[model samples]
Target: MTTGNFPRCNCASGALLQGVELAPGLPALQCPACDGSVLKLDDYRSWQPAPAAVTQPPHVPEIEDRPSARSCPACGRLMQRHRVGSSPDFRVDHCAPCQLVWLDRGEWPALAQAGLAGRLAEILTERWQRRLQNDEIRQQREAALRGKHGDACLDELARIRTWLAEQPHRDELIALLRTGW
Candidate 1:
């Protein structure tokens, strides 16, 4: 139940985290002083059941971003921060090589409420990562486009693209528009 004597709570509790067995063969270090817990990703994944199709996604409350850095208790190294889901809030610290995750106070319960606790694998999927990258790229491109063409021209371009979709030579017109000729 100990990861090399026990991992101290990284949230400045200065208290030794208690190792708790969430499931058989699945152990997690919980902070006695706070709701924070350090979980082994492999254990959590094994404990999680297969994701079911959700008719409507649960609403996740927006948590404020804290300007604090956290380290992996196992390795004593700075952990990378990532949002739990599509929400811009609720960041979690992850040590990729160690496969360990640090959940802040209430973060785990929040994820459960949001119906994402069982689907932690989703964030680790290639498809999800690629989609995030694509979305960022698209945002950057749109910002650049707006800067270069202005809002009015961008609106006009949108209208033109809509109209071009109805035209026969859509591709040719689009190409010309792209070239600005």
Candidate 2:
């Protein structure tokens, strides 16, 4: 429900939506009544940061079975629900066609606290997909190695590999091992 330039808050009807500046030039519609916010994708995407370096395996987010979906303030359409990070409890809504996002009370702060505010676009890219595939492959390889070699041999092999990886001649060592040296 919308009236004039005011976008209605889905959390509570009759709540007046106010224009707020989230950053220097980014504007968002905020509901002072319930603390919910509506941000356009283009507006929110302006704050996107460079993709962070992944040191280890990607952390999989724990998704919960949340049934409720919010309506988009821009189009009155049912917004798509998405989990922020590893926490399944918190969810935000996005209307793809309208390019609008709805954040419930405290969701914005939660995203910021999780360091996900500036990296949302990066997480949905092809690089992220490739990382997930690599993680799956690594897990499968580990399971197979453990099953065939047993824990002791697998542990020793892992230690040896770690040492080899640290060596300056790691590529040469790998090449030699592949040739049955």
Candidate 3:
């Protein structure tokens, strides 16, 4: 989007952003061409998500994910991307210094569908990022284990691990196993 008096879109779409209410009372600058939105964190903090009867994620074929780094519409600086969820995984572009968030087309709807609409602020925190990283790493490790050991062996190990957690002498049992027979 074009930039001058108005905020530009971070998507490099060359369209100037206009004011719009993404949700009731939640004001945001929206791009006409790309349908992307730029919203202030301050506005988001004061706004509430509309309650939905549906609890499942929307059937999104694919949400537009601009994998490349985007500039902040407000500050003209590169924004940092924060992972939101694993299913249909997408990242929200954030400018922490400017307190702004850039949501690509359909990103808001997807986030809301995934039950993460209310946790936008939480997604940008260090703890959340670390948790997301750990989760991805764990998934990778599991995939490797499954590849090498196969599903049956992994499933059995998981079952044993669960059973071992409830035993009174769990440490002793583990030690005996470590020592063989």
The global C-alpha lDDT for each of the candidates, from Candidate 1 onward, is 0.70, 0.67, 0.81
The sequence of per-residue lDDT tens digits that candidate 2 reaches over residues 1-181 is 2335445676646577888854445578888877777777787676543333212214432333235887777778888776554444576777888877777766665555566666555544557546656776898899998999899999998899899989999999899988966
Model 1 clash count equals 0
The per-residue C-alpha lDDT of model 3 at residue 129 equals: 89
TM-score of each: 0.59, 0.59, 0.82
Kindly give the number of clashing pairs for every candidate: 0, 0, 2
Q: CA RMSD for every model?
A: 5.3, 6.8, 3.4
Query: Clashing residue pairs, candidate 3?
Result: 1-14, 1-15
Which regions in candidate 2 have their CA more than 4 angstroms from the true location?
Answer: 1-6, 47-67, 123-161, 167-181
Candidate with top lDDT is 3
Instruction: Report residue 6 deviation for candidate 2 (angstroms).
Output: 5.4
Superposed model 1: Cα runs more than 4 Å off: 1-4, 20-27, 50-65, 125-130, 136-181
lDDT of 3: 0.81
Off by over 4 Å in 3: 1-5, 10-13, 53-61, 87-89, 175-181
By TM-score, the best candidate is: 3
Ranking by lDDT: 3, 1, 2
